[model samples]
Target: MSDSVTSVEAPEIVVPEGVRLEPERLLDLYWYMLLNRRLEERLVNLYRQGKVIGGVYRSLGQEAESVGTAYALEARDYVSPLIRNLGSILVKGAEPVDILKQYMAKGTGPSRGKDLNIHFGDLSKGFIGPVSMLGDMIPVMAGVALGNRMQGKDSVCLVYIGDGGFSTGASHEGWNFICAQRLPVILVAEDNCYAYSTPTDRQMGNRNMVDRAVGYGCAGVQVDGNDVLRCWHAASEAVSRARSGGGPTLIEVKTYRRKGHAEHDDQRYVPPGELDTWEAKDPVARYERWLLSEEIVDRSQLDQIENRVRAKLDAAVDEAEKAPMPEARTALDGVWSTPRWTAEHPNFHDFAAEIGS
Candidate 1:
């Protein structure tokens, strides 16, 4: 496990033969990653100020995995993002202001102040909000893919699970079910070194999680999660395969969680210098270096992109601060639904219209 934390530079960016990204799309990836980082930084500040309703999960080193994978999906495809996957949701059309409001527990949030952090989902945007229980979204996403196939829609579902979450029975059951049914679902196994404080070696016998794909009789591939373009390449292929009825694919994304499980965690269990080592391979920084080295964006262009992201975050923070909280009277508003109430409130007829409902 010590080798996993060794100091290493980012891998060279290699574009697969069939994978082509225009300059505009490349810049878009960089922008989304920057936005993801800046937004989390704002959330950390809000958490310290006591403005946040719950813990803030930071994807400090793993931004590329979320952003790149989701970028490969079409607008019609679906994704189920975990707490650390705020970048994926952003790519799926979630607004920065809504994320801020959700963290601040403002009434204007996607969850209407009912949930905190990125626990809110927008079905219309093709994303399903995650549940607290790890691996639960696996079965749920399987059902989603099945439903899409039944409806004769050529859509795929991408579900993310952590190194630890992969150990759960729910994940196994869902993986088996999807493989047997030949469902159009891509399972992303995030091997981010630790599950809370437990290292990968302590939790599972197989260090390489992607190997399980063979047992499930599905295609699988392993990629450096830090390499944004590589992740995009692999995911794009997986999406194409699933869309073409090739069944499920397991993508093992090798990454590291630079931050603790949450803001409150000090990560005392992490070995000395481990975080620093991973810091050298920071995904966002690596991608920026690639962009600059390849002359994809000059320094001035990068600066402009950073400035735009910061300005958006500033406005989002201000709006979230000014937004009101949920009223006590509305506590039970969405708790239950009756035919009479649905008829009385025509606007609330489609509960799916509400994000994360």
Candidate 2:
């Protein structure tokens, strides 16, 4: 990465024709999105109930985009999500209980009882945590994949960033390195069309995020992110290419963050009827339609799947609650990076003291 950017092959992965209509997978997308949305709603209710503290990210409208992209990954693969990509984390096998535990500031949480307020780092289930800072994680994800390559393991890294993040220096630097090194990273620009109160029309001088990939010298594409199947097909291809040593792929999924920016945001800048427009192409509804249209599964079958998700979530919450809190000193531990942690450094810093275990 000693460079000014150099050219590489335009990454192109073959998207299997007609995969958008896969019934079982399509319905699973619905269940994943619903579980994330519903659980998030519940968390919000609890946050108000004083059961939880600090801010939270909700996956209301962006469920399909995150879940669909994540469904394409294998279990050993890593997904680095932005704070808002709740659905992405969930799709990566992060259970509702794991999230709830963190919200509750329970010791069972991956970060332990400290810094309970910040949604940062959970290594147990392949998620490193949601970076509150935008676009900072892109290079790190690339480095993770590179490290895996060094180890001769077949893990891939999925770096999920927002459209707003694309404007950052980190995005440019990360993209440059990713291309130069030819890392097998998947750069997912979850474009829900707004960077906080600012719209994409204002921030992006260039129309397509995928277009940025051209300069990076890797393959890129965009999808109708609302259609879960469409997103899935595109992402599945990108992931497969990555697995096959096809270098990196940039995916700009056209999506929207349905809710206000965050719990504290009033969202006055949201254009009238904008949410309604996106909602019509809702991923859950679209995926469900595909499922039924294909006769892949019936309502009862879908219900059974939903029931299992519910049960899993329920049990996870209980487990998290009962999980022992990381000792107050735990944070003081693991400070000095070791070889096994052997990845690059200058990224680690402690906010543990501020949160107070």
Write candidate 2's Cα lDDT for 1-357 as tens digits.
212111211112122465754555656677788887777876787777777757766656678778888888888888988777778777777668767888888766756665553375656677776555677888788788889999998887888888888899987898789889888889888778788889998888886787788788998887767766666777788888888889898888777788777787777898799878767766676666666666778889878877877787677656755777666545545554642222132222333233452
Question: For residues 44-111, what per-residue lDDT tens digits would candidate 1 score against the true structure?
Answer: 99899999998999999899999999999999999999999999999999999999999998887888
Stretch of 10 with least lDDT, candidate 2: 2-11
TM-score of each: 0.92, 0.82
User: How many collisions per candidate?
Assistant: 0, 6
For model 2 the TM-score comes to: 0.82
User: Which residue ranges in model 1 land beyond 4 Å of their true spot?
Assistant: 1-10, 336-357
**Global lDDT of model 2:** 0.73
RMSD of 2: 8.4
Alpha-carbon lDDT of model 1: 0.88
